[model samples]
Target: METTALSQDEVLSLIVSQLAAYGFSQLAQTVAEVTGAMVELAPSSRLSELLYLGKEQDESEELEPTEFPTEEDQDEPMEGSTDSYSKYLDFDIETKPIPRPFPDYTQLYYTQHKGPCRCAAFSADGKYAATGSHDTSLKVLDVAKMKNRSGDAGDKPVIRTLYDHVATVNDLSFHPNGLVLASCSDDQSIKLFDLSKPGVKRAFRYLQDTHIVRSICFHPSGDFILAGTDDNSVRIYDVKTFQCYTTPPTTADLHRGGITQVRYSSTGALFATSSADGSVKVWDGVSGKCVRSIENAHAGAPVSSVRVSRNGKYVLSAGRDSFIKLWDVGSGRELVRYEGAMHSRESLQAAFTHNEDFVLMGDENSYTVLCWDTRTGALVKKIQGMLLFIIQLRW
Candidate 1:
């Protein structure tokens, strides 16, 4: 008797369905090393349709790639409040020294974690900072008092360190109310901490997921929580009822790959999701319907993160293609492109400066933070000094 060899899709399916103790780890590692398999999706499955495999690839061709603006040419300031928006419009990128708005920005205020800090978030009031690490610990620190971990502050600035997760923490989000902090981990659980109360070693509330929770965000109203999980689903849970309200009506509406990041617009009128399927979709916050889709958003490379602009007029997305592009929310057109960061491997987060004057992200290869002038796409600054990968960034 002869046996047929397993196909790529068969192997991927096997990796996805198998339990941890049955040698699945070894098989999965081998497959990832050889094929660079970011996420497993069956070829004939409804989800795979988003990949545009085979004949469907022709349809994607009709959506041409964005034409990036010339580096020296600055377009009209994005529609935002009349502060700093137009200040840099006429500043010559080639001649002007990079703006030194904060002279002390380069001075490091280090907070050491026993393990690499994977996710971090600032409370709505910006008085507190929370970081979750691979050590399965979450630390809340007072931002104003944070000093070099090796210096006099030496753990004194740490408000609380909670150990509740059995696995690495993947993401953290703060409720708009500023008194609650939420954290998600690879242990397949999300924990909520009451920041107003102290001396609590464990989360006050817990929520469970079928797969690893990769990213999370809170609704502007603080009434619900949004989570992106490895199950290829974006879920919304009510804060009061703890009931999951995410119900997609069709398979076509679902992401074909694991969601890397999910974020809501400033006004909570819409939300955006980036997937390993190389797509960024904007969905109506009320109806949960995909209002705009940017297919092949990164030329078939997995989009690692997506952020809605502070003004709610643009979207910023980072892809494994090593490019960060800005898109107009109303027109669904790519507006600007920023490069020079080596980020083809890790699922890194990108952010916009508070005033939306600059774009910021981490360089996985160099382990440094890269900031670019948003209007000109010119390298504004590169801050270094990371012992390992910079998984997440927030300014």
Candidate 2:
């Protein structure tokens, strides 16, 4: 049997193929040994040329290059890269441990109001949570005790207040300071309540004669309040004066149909509104000018809710079309679309988590709150129960 020695090109091709198959660490070790011998014999030879040839061979075999951070690069992480060494590259996969089965949430004491509680909000301290029900009442629950007594078989939440509204309360929000609570109702009014005061008289109320108030939110700085109504316009009210600072019909032509959702950007420079006109509009919060308008944003369905991420980079909207659309705020371009079993033509609500990395959404028939990965549009987790609506605990 005659043993034949491999040619330089053949040897280089084999090494490159192995490198592409096995990855960088092993390839580096193998190349070091071969290159050392070649250097000893021909010190002036171009090692770079040899490496280039290896890369060509690897490419011809349709092998992807291994992405490994160098020592210096490891010390200074790349921009937008995760700090975890395990996630040095986006392609790296990390599997989470399977979650333990949920306890019987049915045992958790929850108040069943007369009508559908379509919206909810929590105070800044997370001590209180308020739900707006179609029964024409707003129920405030002591959330702190609810968590502590969750293990108690029959522990019920202490009702903080049973504030009354002439019509169904459609949306509610706690001021950033946690001292004030605001509720919007079908009666076409936005009510402000001072929780610090003991009696109902201390709770102040404000009225708007526009059509039913569909959604309401406070500016991040708590200086102003924004509300969307069925009158096809958005109203901005000054918090201190308790008067309309910027009246509706300012940009009335922007939304031809009823406005369903309005949200202020985290930076307080811009705000977004979604409407039944099949459009979403971004507006300058200070100048009261329309910045950009997205037409047919949710097709023929009215956008039921709109939320801006904490970082002010993305906006999320859910509508009757059973789809959630994500948009880049700066360019006003649609980035991603997410569809889930819970999204429906019926009014659905969506909000960004405190970290802005996850989105929570709910609908009338949904028995669980859907959590989605904002970056990938993937379903991350589900909070099981008959969820009416969800709001981030105000901070």
Candidate 3:
């Protein structure tokens, strides 16, 4: 069985989350202080105090005060829907956001290079994480040992660096077995790492034919790989033979512009592709036949990214239009338009929480992270951070 170690920060974050869930706000705040991520209520919740309360009230009285019904709480639930998360991305309205104290999120960087990590992938066993940078290299880190950088030998998270790519490394995908890791770059080459070797190095043969791979994923069996390209095609190549096994399918040639991303569903029975043409297509992995196509997924701009839920029942896609749409996998119908607090000018990226209760997104335009309630379609949290540019974020 594969094993992954938990970082010290993750353990602390879990503790803080538990504390907050149990209503131990003071204790959660104390843990946040020790963990360096403040556990505070929503700004709106702190916006007003009961004007009727006397200034002489004791602290215990304030702690046990009942929550007044919110304005929307008094309204009847919609006919078929009890909550809303189907609005478009617009922040013109003024409303109070709900409280969400999620502490497991953090930004990691090297104090030395401060590398702009454009893409990253975690190993299958979760023991390692690899990041690609504009510096034209890929660095792997020991996930279990990651901690605050102290500029010492063991203080940094990075464990090894590979220098095969001549341009910015664009993406990474580790094999399901966790022994081999593949990385693609702007230089139009895909290099595989043989992690079991005495010295960390690339596979003897690297895939050399492709048009600037923007996304890549491994075949669940680990013998083949699929790559999405700027040329509007998806190419499958054999890992050992380094030969193209099937005709590269190009969706961009017919006005789609380029293939932005491709992801295999959880069971690997279906693979989905998002394109510059503002569409999302689910296709048979081996047969190359389109299973379901969501035309005009964004309709205004290209769908930049796509993700399938853990159970393979829903599809989540984010776009240049600053919106994320969730769809039912079987009927190919749009289920919800999640545009709560996200207003990002940067290419959007998002993911489903393990349980799919909430969705998290990188808000590049606002320079913060936003979490939306899946059932209510409300922005419950505005996670704070100080990064001027967040090149990559992974759940």
Candidate 4:
């Protein structure tokens, strides 16, 4: 010790080695980088022999009591403490005031898929949502955490990303129970995903169809699924048995063109279908038989989308002719027609707003949304600069 002195580099290296031995590799690296020192630890055999050779008989270490309270004592809150967050303990959604934007604000926006998003469906309770894209992927999102236009709050709305379809995903439907989501794709496949189960990477039930499925909807009871295909066929599949029942072939009544959209009435007593054949048909929900048909519904233009009113007394249909016709479900007659929306090629969706007071449809040509008075059939407002290729709409 009297004859030997350690160099600065040796001292730094020794400090780094000790720090690494105590499992502080990050701190050791930082020291090496800052001091320009080489960090080489002692050989394993020699270090082990030197460190543990005389420590075999050492007594086990015991902890001495400190001023801090034990775990049991800390269970209770400290004296004079106040619960500043007590107001946030429980939230009453009904009492909360809804935010109303003057010009329109996007409640949710996501760009995870590679291709265009084709369809979206909200759960019955509006707490969850599922979207399908042309990129052959489905994303399940948490509605409660949907981000705003600012992209600051609730940033990560998507909770799960699912990839099972080989081709483009066309439609998505959430069961009435809201726990299961069904999706149809142009790949000629249908898949069911149960959202209650965690870490689900694949569908729980997979169905293969002969033709490409364009639309899918779950029955109000969640016991059956109705699908419309590119083959101009409508079919129902039993959820429990996985048995598919095709509509009886009636050459005179069967749709001649591709089935674009299918939906069930609010009462589940009747279901509606819009086809590329330029017709809309309403069928009995129980017997699965066509009851009413509006032939040449769009004046030879393909009926793009159809939706049953909440009362089940009316049906709202959109066609490539750029008209939204309100039809009487009982008389099978057109009630009122709302125009001024440009839709020529894509299957654009039309929807009814609160209490069926106003009907709305997206214009594929101008990327605008047109709202009209349901009773007067007069255009009310035009929301411009909306997204394109809107295939579905719900109140």
Candidate 5:
């Protein structure tokens, strides 16, 4: 028969008590909406009480949620999603599942060589993988049988031995045509080997005066080779003419600090360089002008590797700070900063998957190679091995 009006404090207390019973997560959603509405109605009143209540509730409910999809569920399509092409909305596409317990890498295979391997490359056809180790030997593994879409462990790859380098081989690149293999080393030279040739004796070596070649890459057209060295410059070599053109970066008065890695853009018109000076530099492959420089890009650590997305729109850099930075290549602005243990150490090398949907990074710890979803920054797959380096096979 009687109605009593509750004071503002009483109303707030009752709301908070109910939210506490429902749990902090649900309370958070409710409070967010209520706060938004409250701001619109009365901007002066501070939601301090509600904010404190939410904080206390969150502290009490500290355990993380367990409603995660199983590995099997990850492979299946959503139930209500239509099979028609038009039903494929932007958010409807299934995301790669996150790894459980993270990925533990162990040595899958290792061979005793003369020195430490500085680089590795997979054949363009995906039939073989070559490693240039510190042992001064080039080892090729027959990955033909190991080429499974699921990446599950199977038969071990057959190993072929090629001993040539007197010093650590720092870089290895396979030509796009699949017939020639190129390698650079601390010995200050780049060697081209013809797989069609019979043995180690049949391989032809190209000697360069540049010492400590840190990185080497083959152009998309396979007509030229790009090599980055400790000399603080990048050299472009014409494979046929055996002539080399050097790009000396004088804009910043230095080539960052010993160009650690170099890559040719997918379009072949541009290239990216990652240096120990904590910078990522983009240069015109033809004119050699430093178009964009992201200085202090990865502060407190060296920029170990840089990769351009297959679409040439995104540039991803991994650094010693254990951070992977995603940048808009066109505007030269950072888009995302992913900081986690998976990327939390020196990511010595990185490669983009065939679809450019994921990036695989090789870390110094355990020689672990991890795959990250380019869009979501989620861990996709991990390959275990003591890697000298990891590279995606490009066909």
Candidate 6:
């Protein structure tokens, strides 16, 4: 931590610097309240971070080959708030010593998919990219070969496309070993792709009657896969036996709503789910027992997405009500609320940056992604020009 004397201007500068460089709005606000010095998002801290940053890739190592470049330079900085709507920002400008030795940013784009991609994932080794799309198809790409992931041509060749589903594939996850890809669809099927093979093909497919497989996740140990269906129950499937447990995670007598999303903790010790009722449940990852449940979590608004933090300490949920709330994993109580970007009536996605400094989310109506300071709920940036109605973003 960079410490400074309370009387110096560096106090204010330090507070604002970390807030922009990181997402420590709590520190910025605390210092601002103590000193009465207005703080704001620093202009110089973000341009390089946003336009240049990516998972560092070696020339030899590959995350499944793609046409995308590892880095790029931006002619201008990303657009931030200037209108009256941006009331949380510090309106007045102040000078502070610029931080030296900014990190270089490289950008990559992958655009071979035929339609709007509803879901996507990178292989555990970062070697391949898989997408579930509106065309009711799934495409797997070689990220290493493309060099750059972005492509304007929708017809760009992919390893293969799987087309067995009749409806949109809502979510997809990779086995821990990256040997297989699992997907769940609104068409009422849970399918697994054998990535260990050179070509794309289904290794297993489980058909369901009335329930749509809305979401699915793999255990960190690669033992089993968890599926959440529209029928309001969670099912576990054994990878070896290819059989789904006859029992649901909760009692069959419980009247739960359709599960909108599911995520496992970093250790795979616990997993959590969000339902159509905006409620949430935490279950033991191994035993598949519902240990904690939050009812009416967002006051009846359907949860669009749910994620456990990279540190496994916090759980975040994005809702149809147009807000993202952070929760204490232990207490199950809401801690912070992030808002101000458009997500109303859409299943916009939310997740933490790799380092967990900021909370990132996308808006369907705005066609942009917004960054919020995680420690305190402050809109840091509104980013555009990279994606369209981004429903999928992963590190």
* Top TM-score hit: 1
Task: Provide C-alpha RMSD values for all models, in order.
Answer: 19.0, 18.8, 17.0, 25.7, 19.0, 14.2
Question: Candidate 2 lDDT, tens digit per residue, 163-280?
Answer: 6578888888889888788998899888888877655632476766568888898876686789888877678888777777443355544688888888886545567898988788
Candidate 3 versus truth, CA RMSD in Å, comes to 17.0
lDDT of each residue in 74-117, candidate 5, tens digit only: 33334553331121112224343322232333444544555555
Error of 4 at 233 (Å): 2.7
CA lDDT of every candidate: 0.75, 0.66, 0.66, 0.75, 0.64, 0.67
What TM-score, over all chains together, does every model reach?
A: 0.73, 0.67, 0.68, 0.70, 0.65, 0.68
> Candidate 2: minimum summed lDDT over ten consecutive residues — where?
85-94
lDDT of 6 by residue, 35-127 (tens): 877656441233222222222223224445457543322111124422211111121231221111222323454455576789988777877
User: Which pairs in model 2 have colliding backbones?
Assistant: 320-345
Q: Which residue window of length 10 is worst by lDDT in model 1?
A: 41-50
Task: Provide the clashing-pair count of each candidate structure.
Answer: 0, 1, 2, 0, 11, 33
- Cα error of candidate 6 at position 275, Å: 0.5
The TM-score of predicted model 3 comes to 0.68
Off by over 4 Å in 5: 1-116, 145-159, 248-250, 342-347, 363-367, 379-395
- Pitting candidate 1 against candidate 5, the one with the higher TM-score is 1
- Between candidates 1 and 4, name the one with more favorable TM-score: 1
Clashing pairs in 1: none
Instruction: Write model 4 residue lDDT over 40-137, tens digit each, in one string.
Output: 74211223223442352241133346598553233222344322111111112223222211223244555557888888888988888888888999
